[model samples]
Structure formats: C-alpha cells, structure tokens
Target: MTGTTWDILLLGGASGIGKSRAAARLAAGTDGFIVEFDDVVSAVQAITTAEHHPALHHFDHAPDTARLTNDQVLALQIATAQALEPAVLGVVRNRLTVDTPALIEGDYLTPAAAARAVDDGQAAGRRVRAAFLHEDEPEQIAANYATREPDDGDQTERADVSARYSHWLAQQARTYALPVVPCRPWDTLPARIREAVD
Candidate 1:
C-alpha cells in the first residue's frame, strides 16, 4: 500500500507463468476485481479500427509467425502489448473510481508501464503492488504449456518466446525495483505473489 488513487496488484510475466491463477488466488482472500488484459484488448479491437492497430493482431486472422525470426515474434508481441497499455490503464482508472480494488494480470502489463502507472498516480492506493513472475527454464515453461494445451504444436516457438520475454521481464522488474517471483512449477507461486502484494 503506497499510492492514493486506487489499490492495484499488477501481475506481469511471460505466458504459461500462472499469472491468472495467481490473481484468482489473490482475489479469493481480497476484495479485488479481475481484469484480464486479453479482455480489454479484445473489447478495444471490437470497437476500434483494428485494421490500423498492430496490437489487434490477436483478433481476426493473425499472421503465421512460425516462419518468422525470434526477433520478429518478440517485436510483434511487444507492439501489441504496448498498444494494450492504454486500455489496461483505462480499465484500471475506471475500476479505481469504484469501491473494489483490481487484480490486473497479463503479460502485457510491462514493468515500465506499471511503474509509469504508479508514478503517474493512476495506481493510487495504500497498497499499490506490482510484480513479474517467470519460469526461467524454457523446458519447464514448455511443460507448463503442454498441461494447458496438450495439442500445442508450436510448443518450441512458444517456449522460446516465453523464455526471452520472461528474461526481459525479470530484468525490467529488477530495473524498476519491483518484485521478481520465480514461479517454478513446484513452488507455491500464489503464496509468493501474495507476499509480494502484501
């Protein structure tokens, strides 16, 4: 609890890192509303001129990035995430005006953006907490994905992207002085996130 506008617990990390699960666990014991980054991005895509927005690629027909280089994939994802930042902040702003706190969980909630939100007073609360979770090992991350979607044919690509993004996120969190939680499959990750938020 550090800010004065609204209480927000921003969970950011790579895919398959259990952010949504962590947020759900956090919400169970707290009066917090859940806002998925995908939902906001999807809603925005539905209303806006998505054709012109690079971030809206998740909607409609997405380009097959299987053949693209790793850097290209990262660039595409980062662009989309950056584009979703405003909408995420909008959701945060709206939720703040209400009485309930919010648990915003997503890969798109970059450390830089979270820090900006706090510094800009958008996350005004006595408990403005933000952290990044990651499974450093690509094989472990791929294993996590397998459990979620057993038919995933792009496991290798997904794992690579997750590893790269997770590394970047961890560094970003450290750079911003935010908590960095290692969410290894065997760990009690939700508890770690709870500790970070508390």
Candidate 2:
C-alpha cells in the first residue's frame, strides 16, 4: 500500500440527470475506473434468490414486482438503496486501496455516505470529491428517461420519483457541503463536474 490517498470521484444524482455522461468524461480525462451502483445491484441480483434481497424488490425488477404500484415500487427502490450502502462503501474501500484512480457514479451514492469516506484517514493526502446532479423540472427529467433506448416502465412515474429523489439528494449535498450541479440541458455538465472536483 502506498502512503498516498487514492483519487475517488463520487457522482450522485437522480435518474436521467446526466451523471453517466459526466462520469464518462471524468474517466476519460483522469483515466479513472467507473463503478456504477446499478451494475453492482444487478450483479448481486444475478447470484441471489433471496426473497428479502433489497435489489430484488426494486422497481427495476419488473418481472418480480409486476403487481406492484408505482408508489410501492418507489418505496422498494429507496429501501434497496439504503440496503446497498455497506456493499457500495466496501467497493469504495477496495478500490481506494489500489493505486489506480476510480470514479464511483450512481444515484445510490448519497452525499452523506460520500462525506464519511471523504473524512476518513484513507482519504488523507488524496482527493476524494463528490457531486450531485439535479434537474429542476420533473417533466424534463421524464422526457430524458423517455429518450433511453431500452424502455422500462412508465417514464412519467419514474420521473416523478426522480424529482423527489433529486430534492432529497440536494438536501444531502447541502448537509455534506458537496457540490450540487444543475444538469438540465447537460450542455456544460462535464466542465462543471470537473470544476467541482478540482
């Protein structure tokens, strides 16, 4: 292990808020590895048949939650996020132990949790930054989701949930003093993200 802290950039935000693109740009510039929480959740779900597994109950698992209403699905999504904290933090710890820089991006990486990592002894002498992206209009966010290739459930419902999540994320960012960037049009998101991390 080196005596330097590893560079880990954490991007958190609502769905369809341009976090994916921002992460891609950062990774391209910094040669950083990307660790997405949704991918992590999917990987966990593939190997588990646990009925109580949080990810299994998420709205993304449409087949399983076919009978659930949008509100129920949203509740399950929140629960799954809370349940994944330990796993996400563990991944961060392992990644930071290595020399390579990493960019951990996803909706589940809350500002408070990132702040805990930011203040840890492991982050001393190294850069550990976090940013949250948000879109003011839920309709615009819904439109972004509607544009995705692989269609999921109702875009409007997802957007509504995303809007609520964004507000919550903003509060968390404020509480942790993390940067909250607007990604409405995503015209300058990558640049703004770079500035925030720097």
Candidate 3:
C-alpha cells in the first residue's frame, strides 16, 4: 500500500446534499472512513469554548442570532482544518500502509486545500480525487433539511445557507476542475459514487 495508493476521494457539498451518504456508501464498499468536517468543528468549538465568540450575521436584516461574521467563520474553519489535518493524514497513512482506500466526507476543504492535498498525496505516492455534490433544485434541498432536522445551533439557518453554499461549491468545482456530481435524491447518489470510486 505504501507504494502507490488510489485517489483520496473527497466528497464536498452543501449541507444535506448527500455528501455524507455517498461517502458512507463508498466507505462501506471500500477500506475507508468518514470524516465529517462539521463534527470536527463542533468538537473544536467545544474544546475551545473559552475562546468562542458570538458569530455575527452576514446580512443586515438577518436575525441577531443568525449572523456569523466572516472572521468568526474563518476562525472556526481554520480551527476545523487544523483539527482535521492529523485525522486526515492518519487515514491517508493507514490506507497507504495497508494498501487500502479512504473516502473523506467534508465541506471544509476549499479548492485550494483540495489541490494542496492532491500534491501532498502524490508526493507521498497516493492519488487524490475530489468530488463536489450539487443539488438540482433548492426545493429538494429544503425538503432534505426538513427531513434531517439538524441541530438548532449551527444548522438552524441551513435552508438559506445551503443555497448559497451550493452555488459557491458549484463555482469552485468548475474553477478547480473538480468533478461535480449532481445528486437528484438520496437513493441515486450511492450508485454514482460507486461508479466514480470503481
């Protein structure tokens, strides 16, 4: 496994866009693990509770509780990236050592980060592939939000943020040449990922 490894599959997308589901299926079918980026951030936030500050809203009319400033979000994102590094590296190393594969599920990896990972993986004798998920319609994503019922704290405003994130992700994927997988529904995503992985 240390010789040359398969691509490090990264599934990134808007919340509730089936990135996790696709990653789960990939992991189930291959030798991989699921690393949820949001979970990593939450864990860091809990540990650094002392440093945690109220997030400022982006919109002027946004609810007082709903605003999260760019600086605040960037801080959280950096912390999350730091926390995820060791974990991600561990997975990559383990897979390489044992000649296995890893399917990492997260949204924190910006296109630049993805490219960096690709370079690092290649240097370490492993390939890296990125997949960005996209939802065809906002209505479907809203329905998914209703079904998931994510926690009230970070994801309470998911319905609105998801659209923004999805659009941003799509643009990033196009700009970075990352593969974009359009997910129509939960049932269809696993098969698509399977095809990609296979």
Candidate 4:
C-alpha cells in the first residue's frame, strides 16, 4: 500500500443541492483534495475526442446528443467508468500524500460503487464516510435549474429530475445507513457540510 494516508468523503444527493459547493468548502477548510465527477466527465470527453473514432464520437456530447440512443448513452457511461477506474485508483494510491481527507462529489456513483470505495479506503488504513444532501422543496430546485443558461451543458428542462433524485437519495440513505444532511437557503450549505464533515 502507498504510504500516503487519506479519507474518502463522498457528497452525493439531488442535483443543485449544493454537493459541489459543499465539497469546495470542505477542501478549503480542511486542506483536503476534491475530486468532482463533472471534471471526470470533462476529462473523459477530452479523451474521447483524442481517440476520434466514429463509434466513440457519440460520447462527445454524451446524453445530450440527440442522435445517440439510450443504449448508446449507457454504453458510453460504462466505457467512461471503465476508463476512469484505473485513474481513480492511481489517485487514491499515489496522489494523496497527507493525512487530510479526500472529498469526492458526485450524484452518479452507485450505492455499490460507493461502498466499494469506502471498503478500499479502509483496507488502505484510511477513514471514509458518505453523506447524502437533500432539499425539501422542489420549487427551490426548479429555481436553481431555471437560472442556468439555455446552452449550458448541464441544463435540464425537467425539474422532476431533481425531485426524483431526492427520493432516490433518501432511499439510498436509509438503505446504506448514511447520514442525510438537509440543506436549504443554499448559502448556508457550506456550514452544513463543514458540520457534517466534523
């Protein structure tokens, strides 16, 4: 095992629930490292572009691409996961050199994957914890989504996604026995996250 010691803290919940914002605060306050899933997506997009094959070109815009079927998007997600696994392992193994925690923020990591990450970190003598953030109001989430630009890649027209994800996260929290941190007024999310991490 690598000599570096770290903790894997995952921030997952409904979209626009302030997962990324909380992660940034955690990193700043604790002098820890942050690994954001969107950055991983961007890197995967860049790698797909470098390969530049017709079959892989569909990944350029991913789920947003109108030409690709649902099956194709699923395939791309699988491929990206496979490609990222090694890099993630490497980062966990070699990049972290301090005892500070590592925060991984994403809504996409499955329950199984998150459990595996925690197990792996424990096996390496590092502490790990997973938290799910939730917001009670659907209208609040809708307002957040509405603020995004029309051309923003992360834009979603359907506010149901946020509500659906909140329900899904709630179930996951119960199933996994993870802490459910309720966030509101978005501005105070950072303090909430700090308290959770503490």
Candidate 5:
C-alpha cells in the first residue's frame, strides 16, 4: 500500500535505527501524519498503575543503565512490547474505522504484534503496511548515532543494544513475512524505506 493507500503504517525497529527519520521521510513523501507509539504507551501508563502494567512501568523511575546487561535491556523491551501489543492493536482497529492517515512509529509493535495488525486489517479490507529498518553492523549504527548527534560521546553500549534488538526484529520480520529494510548506505535509506512499505 503505497503510503497513500494505507490507513495506518506500522513502522518499528530498535532505538537509533533511523525509524524516526523513516517516519518523517515517509510522512513527507505521502499524505500521512506521524504518531509516535511511545505516545500511546505513555497515555496507557498515565491511566493505569504499575500493578496493571508492570512491564510498561519497569523503567518509570529510570534505573541505572550501567547496572543492566544488554540481554536484560532487550528483555525489558520485549516485555514492554508484549504489554503494549493490545494497545497497538486497539489503535490499528480504531484507525480501520476512521480516516486516520497515520504512520505509527516505535518498537512497541514487534513483528508478531504487527502481524496481528496486518491480519486484522486484511480481515477488515483495510490497508495496513508494516516495515522495520535494521542495521546488522553495530559499528555502523554507532557511526550513524554519532552523525545524528555530533556532540554526543561514545555510544558503544547503546549501539550494541540497538544492534542486538534490530537482529531480533529482523528475524521476527522474516518469520512473519514482513518487510525488513536495511538502514545502511545512509544516502539511499529514505528512498529504500519508502519503497519497502509501499
């Protein structure tokens, strides 16, 4: 569904994977609006309590990042994504009935979650495209991070997490038959992303 034909586009990937840029580029290239999935997670957290959304609130207090391992961080992300899957689906279902030309951006909708949305959209005869941007090389992601934030110091740890998370997302995308676009060769990234979701 070339952006124009889709009602909602589910754009997902790990942090620092150019998802934000993809959303902006895609939105600019089409008649679509951007809606951060984090906003939905935040709204749900605001109306709920830790007891109800423990995964979503695990990092509410912003615990020490140094204390956690990469696997641990990945697990937290998976848990949070699991907790927010329903909300994501709810938004997709709601959009199916409305005229919202939105591109939902974030890691909240993992490939599994996005598959559900795609299935629902199919059942309702609505177009909902999903694409995930990934970078297999952690070093490349770190370099991109550096380019995005020239003043920021080394981002080795962050890049490691992002790389690992991106691998997981890519694998899941393959399993679900979803699009997994490369975020490399930065110059052609935007065009590739637009083509992938289209």
Candidate 6:
C-alpha cells in the first residue's frame, strides 16, 4: 500500500478508529480515489425501502441508539455489511479496468467479507487487498468519539459499542487471515498498516 500500486484497497474497522484517515493516506500515497462506504450506504438507502432491505435502513428511523443493545447494534451492522458485501466485490472487480485505483472504506465494509472478496479477486487474477483498523482502548475510542462529535453526549455508549465491535472485527479478521492493525500514536498508523498488509 505504501510503495506499490493496487487495483483496489478495502479498508474496514469499527467506527471512529480512523479508517477514513488511513484510507486518505493510502489514497494519497497511491494517487487513488477514496470511496466512502457511508455514501454507498446512503445511495442504497435512497433507492430501496425498508420493506425490501431492512438492514440497510435499520437505524434510519431509529434516532435513539441508546435504546438498542450492543449485540443488536452489532448484528445490524453485520447484516448491513453482508448485504453490501457483494456489491462491494462487484465494484472492485469492475473498477479494475479503470486507470485510477480507489480505497473503498467504512464500517459497513466488514473485515472478513472484504478479505474474502480480495481473495476472490486474487483467485481470479486481480490485484486487490484489504486491512482492518482496531483500537484496543475503549477509553481512547470514547475520547475520539466525543472529540469528533462534541454535541453527542452518548460517546461513552458509542464507545462501548465500537469497542465490542472492534474486538469482534479483529476476531473475524484473524479467522480470515486478514491483517488487523492497531490504530494509535497517529503518526505510525500508516506504517503499521502498510507493514501488516505488505
């Protein structure tokens, strides 16, 4: 990711752990575009209704995340990722023809699913790779969340959900043989991710 070119890069992780920051670095390094999966999700939600795609719109109508259990939130995230995984693969595969490369990144891009798609691309003779970011400290994540959204007083709860999700995401990444890089000391995160993925 640091020195070499790629057809596509899939970056996934728990919320507020700097997946976007890492993607920006990779995209800048590679002179590629950054594709935010949140935008993809928004686009999907626009064309589809909850009746057809409930997971994609599960949180749309529900403004209060505090009412939902951590497990429920995680389940919804996973479900939405599963639903979008195939399209993600397709976009990566099709975009291979273009001269410009891209980093498709967001929480919606599950590590295991993205890794599987990368593997599929490789098996079919394509150049694609994936890496996940993780934050081991829930407190740090909470601080990051709070800093990112000062008005959101529920950062502690968000941090709890993100921490649990990060742990589960790391487990899945390991099980699928994908690199899970710890995001901290901000300056060294890019190097660590490059080392792990390279």
- lDDT by residue (30-145, candidate 4, tens digit) is 65678776676566566666356434344555556556554454455445444554445544455334565677777554444555566677777776666778877767676677
- Per-residue CA lDDT of candidate 1, range 109-168, in tens? 888778776664433554456888988888887878888889866597778888898898
Best by lDDT: 5
Q: lDDT tens string, model 2, 15-74?
A: 887788877866774556788878987787787655666455465456766476766766
Candidate 3 C-alpha lDDT tens digits along 32-90: 55667666546645564333432311222234533675444434444444345554555
- Runs of candidate 1 with Cα error greater than 4 angstroms are 1-6, 55-63, 121-126, 185-187
What's the distance in Å from true for residue 76, model 4? 11
- Measured by TM-score, the strongest candidate is 6
Query: Over the full model, what C-alpha lDDT does candidate 5 score relative to the true structure?
Result: 0.83
TM-score of each: 0.85, 0.81, 0.68, 0.65, 0.88, 0.89
Residue 187 miss distance in model 6 (angstroms): 1.0
Pairs of residues at least 3 apart in sequence or in different chains that clash in candidate 4: none
Instruction: Give the whole-model CA lDDT for all candidates, comma-separated.
Output: 0.74, 0.73, 0.60, 0.60, 0.83, 0.79
Candidate 4 Cα errors over 4 Å, as ranges: 1-6, 45-100, 148-156, 185-198
| Total clashes in model 2, counting residue pairs 3 or more apart in sequence or in different chains | 0
Clashing residue pairs in candidate 5 (N, C-alpha, C atoms within 3 angstroms): none
For model 5, how does the per-residue alpha-carbon lDDT over 1-198 read when each residue is reduced to its tens digit?
A: 243657788989988878888788778856567889888888998998877767677666447866898888777777778778889999889888876578899977789889999999999988888988888988888988899988999998889988999998999999999999988777788777667767
RMSD of each: 3.4, 3.9, 5.8, 5.7, 2.3, 2.1
The sequence of per-residue lDDT tens digits that candidate 6 reaches over residues 1-198 is: 336545677888989888888778766745678888788777888999988877667776567866888888777777777788766777776667676767788887777568777877787676788888988887999888888888978677778778888888888888888888889889988778777766
- In model 2, the clashing pairs are none
Higher TM-score: candidate 1 or 2?
1
Taking the candidates one at a time, how many backbone clashes does each contain? Answer: 8, 0, 4, 0, 0, 0
Instruction: Tell me the TM-score of model 5.
Output: 0.88
Model 5 residue 28 CA deviation (Å) reads 1.0
Evaluate model 6: give its TM-score: 0.89
Model 1 residue pairs with clashes: 1-126, 1-127, 2-126, 3-125, 4-124, 4-125, 5-124, 6-124
